[model samples]
Target: MNNNAYNINIFSGGAELLFDNKRHYNIDLPNKDTWKLGDLLIWLRDNLLSERPELFIQNNSVRPGILVLVNDSDWELMVSSDLWYLICSLCQILCKYAPCP
Candidate 1:
């Protein structure tokens, strides 16, 4: 499978703390034509998560507190386990999850 590049902008509301306090990333996901948002979450955990992975993902999905957006649209609007927008699934994900204070 070939690698595909995607960009995800993180906010303090999400897992930014685990990503070096950064907020922008251009990541790559394998393109076997079978990747989905669910798969992406796992990939993030395995490849990008720096610490406390449980904070971002749990029970095979993103924790309840976090909110996910794609192309400025709610991820729930498009969270299928199939190829979503072959144009750029991972490229347009924006996550928000305010850490408990």
Candidate 2:
């Protein structure tokens, strides 16, 4: 198995139903040096998501109510070209708030 790992935490905010009431996952990222946020998103859709993925993603981006943080900082701060590369360098968290269901 691939050992490139990422830590992720999920908060329901009513979205947990689609994820089988589960809230956290540790994923082994694909072994690629160019891995980026966009790549991670696609990986999540394929690997971690359960159903109704639209609640977490829309228009090839995260839904409005979702937040992405990296190493305790907002992912927005480091965004470039709709992607941020080499995300395996730190912890990542994707969370949703309020009635996002």
Candidate 3:
């Protein structure tokens, strides 16, 4: 992945987006990430939908939602999701190659 770019997909409510560097747009994320599906959903709900709606892309794109099964466990047990683990791991890796702000 391009660490220099904040090419993260922000999803909230009914929006999907790709923030490539500082340029945001609507795009399809047909790839997989390390985040636990449920945790990512929670993060999006809290961060994007409720907090910074400006980071979301408003267009006719598919909802940018994280969909993944963590260790074959359904994400309804609340704490069994691996989303935070994946996020923390990814953050550590990205931090090593962070782009200068």
Candidate 4:
């Protein structure tokens, strides 16, 4: 395990269709002393997202109706003084989307 790199697992629920229909992914992020959830989002959008990026990203963040979970916890609950949450090594990120009627 590279100390500077973070190996993370990403899972997609209903949103997997945008990721080539793959539900799980293991990826290594470039070395950095600190990584924020926002950074990860950009990385996913640039690297993992396969199609229909508009449906996944909006205003530099995930579009409405998309749920992002880090280590099984809702990202919204993890926000603090800084809106962007910190991410650690071996973290698990899940993106789920629930369409509205």
Pick by lDDT: which candidate is best? Answer: 4
Candidates 2 and 3 compared by TM-score, better number? 2
Residue-wise C-alpha lDDT for candidate 1, range 1-101, written one tens digit per residue: 23577777664565688777788888766656766677777788898888898888888778888887877887766656343433455457777886878
Residue-level lDDT of model 3, residues 1-101, one tens digit each, is 53222223322222332222322222222345545433444443344343344333223211234222233332334345432444322221110111223
How far off is residue 72 in model 2, in Å? 2.3
RMSD of 1: 3.4
TM-score preference between candidates 1 and 3, better one = 1
Each candidate's TM vs. the true structure? Answer: 0.78, 0.75, 0.24, 0.87
Best-to-worst order by lDDT is 4, 1, 2, 3
C-alpha lDDT (0 to 100) for residue 33 of candidate 4: 75
Cα-based RMSD of the predictions, in order?
3.4, 2.8, 13.6, 1.9
Consecutive 10-residue window with the lowest summed lDDT within model 2: 92-101
**Tens digits of lDDT, candidate 2, 26-101:** 7777678677787787777777778888777788887877766666667778776456545664466656545533
Compared with the true structure, model 4 gives a TM-score of 0.87
Q: Model-by-model lDDT, in order? A: 0.72, 0.69, 0.31, 0.80
List the candidate numbers ranked by TM-score, top first: 4, 1, 2, 3
Candidate 3 residue pairs in clash (backbone atoms < 3 Å): 36-83
Query: In terms of TM-score, which candidate is strongest?
Result: 4
